[model samples]
Target: MTTAPSHPTDPTMNAIGQAVAEAREGDVAAARRKLLSLWSGIGVTGDPLHRCTLAHHLADLYEDPAQALAWDIRALDAAGAVTDQRVQQHHAALHIAGFFPSLHLNLADDFRRLGSFEAAAEHLNAAEESAPALPRDGYGALLRTAIRQVAEAVAQRDTAKRDTAPGRTA
Candidate 1:
């Protein structure tokens, strides 16, 4: 999974990003505590950007695939409510279109990990469909790579299952 980029100007987001970085560096417990604290501050009815950012990072804190999928869904729902005016006011460069790819990619991966290849493929398709709206930059490349990797993994797993089925010959 790719590291979430930081928004230096937003303290809450910066803190969340820092926690995520700490988690990536092998301090997951600390990161989870920090994120939970932030989540408490930004409740369910909080601003869309905060909800989206917090949920996106919070999903990574879960060891359980199902829990992570739940958080990804929350993030996607919050992203849908984030408007361009809010982005401009907050000086956030995030576009709702850009958020979909990451949210769907994460959901796809979670579904694949849970042995749900059809759901995974559906999310992968959503990610691909939203890819073109992403800015043509390194972040976009990373999202594209993640989408491809998940798609390939899902296909390989499906093929393996087919090949091992009863009465099937190689």
Candidate 2:
């Protein structure tokens, strides 16, 4: 295992959490601003876990599908570079594989909104295929349910934003 500090003890992680908390507080503009500042500091080649987490949240702050898709892609790309040891260093319970379902789901949703059903289906299927890595908890259940919801929307060729989708009320 690396020498990375635990999530709460890590300064960068704490900063990311503060920004995410700001978003959860409904001050999305503030959160986006804060996260963008952090991203500038972190850069594209920063720690993969940090990149993954930051880009994932940053994607949600954008109402535009293209912008969100770009961030989502970055999140997924970062996830690919992350390791289980690095993830466990931040949170003992976190494993790198557990991040994929949500990452792919977000990408699927982004592609769906952009009217790219084929690409959306591919990522959606990847999300489902990666579901086994998800824990049997509320968060996992939520992702599973969201995957189903996204699948339904895809089947119907609906491009409108989902009311239940995380972040960015559109």
Candidate 3:
């Protein structure tokens, strides 16, 4: 089931929304700064759902990826703590942790570029797990595609090496 928005009438949430609107209207720095202020006030201890909402907002609005990722991890931990549904938390964390198929695929590409085929395979496998939750035609598909592509590459490399050996047949 879909979760409810954190307090429909909270002034803080309203302010955040306004700032986001302003950011969308071309005052990105101002909007982000406003979010940062509100973000600091959001204490770590509170209703898990409320924290999740705030965390999601922070993750979406923050300009710095490191900061956003920190908030995402916090949200995931809080969600896991409050609910019996561990799978949902895992899914949310994956999204927040740059595990979306596209991100994972890009990461795999970087590993491939560095000649770390094993690491690339590991990342591709992770990307595959998150693929079911990602958009079928967009980032998610890219992740699944990347996994397959990398797996094929690994297989080809292995085959090439084997074929070149004196004892191996073509």
Instruction: Judging by lDDT against the true structure, name the best candidate.
Output: 2
Q: What lDDT tens digits, residue by residue, belong to model 3 across residues 1-170?
A: 12223344466656766765676677767766776676677677755544554564455444443454455556555554455343243234333333344344444444554456786677677667756766545545544554676667664543122111111111
What's the lDDT for candidate 1? 0.75
User: Candidate 2 local accuracy as lDDT?
Assistant: 0.88
lDDT of 2 by residue, 65-150 (tens): 89999999999999999988988888887788889999999999999999999999999999999999988978889999999999
lDDT (0 to 1) per candidate: 0.75, 0.88, 0.51
- Tell how far residue 41 is off in model 1, in angstroms: 1.9
Our tally of clashes for model 1 stands at: 0
Cα deviation of 76 in candidate 2 (Å)? 0.2
Give candidate 2's error at residue 144 in angstroms. 0.6
Which runs in model 1 stand beyond 4 Å of their true positions? 1-10, 158-170
Q: How do the residues 11-117 of candidate 1 rate in per-residue lDDT, one tens digit apiece? A: 87688778877877777788878988998998888888888877887787776778887888889888889897776555546556767888888888888878999
Error of 1 at 79 (Å): 0.7
Q: Largest TM-score belongs to which candidate?
A: 2
Query: Rank by TM-score, descending?
Result: 2, 1, 3
